[model samples]
Target: MKVSFTYDKKQVLQALRYHFLSRKEIRLMIILVNVFALGSAFLFYFKKILPLAFLVGSFLWFILMLSFWFFLPGMVYRRATTFKDHFIMTFDPDSFSVGNERGSRSYPWKAVSNFLETPHFFHLYFDSRSFFLVPKDSFSNSDEIYQMRHMLKEKIKN
Candidate 1:
């Protein structure tokens, strides 16, 4: 059988979280923080006229600011993600599937290693935390999603 589905970004992101956060997002955040942190360190180091206490305080303050800024944005960015369709995903029992935006990955159901579902999405994990998210919004109603959700509940726990 084939199951066709569509979803927006938030739903997809939630599904991905079960296995991994988007590398693009995490990497970009890291790069931003590192850049700022390095910049702060350099600024402080160059200010040779400053007191030793001021230098230590500046370093501590920047480190704290960097850590807080990094974590807060990640949390907020994640929690505020929207449900806009970046792609589509189709699954067939016969190892055929296609997802929009991204190219496609076709492998048998046997190739799938696990599954996870949250309140709003379905996750089919072919590897740990690496998965596709099928949003509940793709179904006609909560019941249908629940039914479909229950149907596959047994097939994956891997």
Candidate 2:
């Protein structure tokens, strides 16, 4: 099957956030920060910690969330020219190919280590840190999306 599409900024940004949060390290950090913030709040309420300590913890949590939710994704979207291009992608049992006016590249099923499905995109992950987003809206219908999803499950183990 084949589909052609361009990335929507809003959807792409959300997908990026999904990708970032899905990482083990990032999730761990977020959890740790949340624990700290909660602990700080409790301590402040009991007068065990100074107001300054609670404020610092709150500020740190806020900045971390802000960076992941906005700065990181926006920076990546702007820096990577791939998201701005129109693409045609083809999927088959043996391999998949993606191309634009500039050029095309084909890869065997083994190239993708795993895949993740979000509400708006399929993230084809080459490794822990790299991936390509295929917009779900580009598919002609729900059946095509289902076919693509099944094909991906068969070809890649996640």
Count of steric clashes across candidates, in order: 3, 0
TM-score of 1: 0.46
Q: On a 0 to 100 scale, what is the lDDT of residue 98 in model 2?
A: 98
- Compose the digit string of candidate 1's lDDT tens values, residues 1-158: 33455455454444544334333565565567656556666666788434554556566656755544454435644674233334444544355465555466666766667666677776667775345566667676767776666656544445
Clash count in backbone of candidate 1: 3
* The candidate that achieves the highest lDDT relative to the unseen native structure: 2
lDDT of 2 at 111: 96
**Highest TM-score model number:** 2
Worst 10 residues of 2 by lDDT: 149-158
lDDT of 2 at 26: 97
| 135: Cα error in model 1, Å | 1.1
Instruction: For model 1, state the Cα shift of residue 95 in Å.
Output: 3.6
Query: Clashing pairs in model 1?
Result: 8-83, 9-84, 19-129
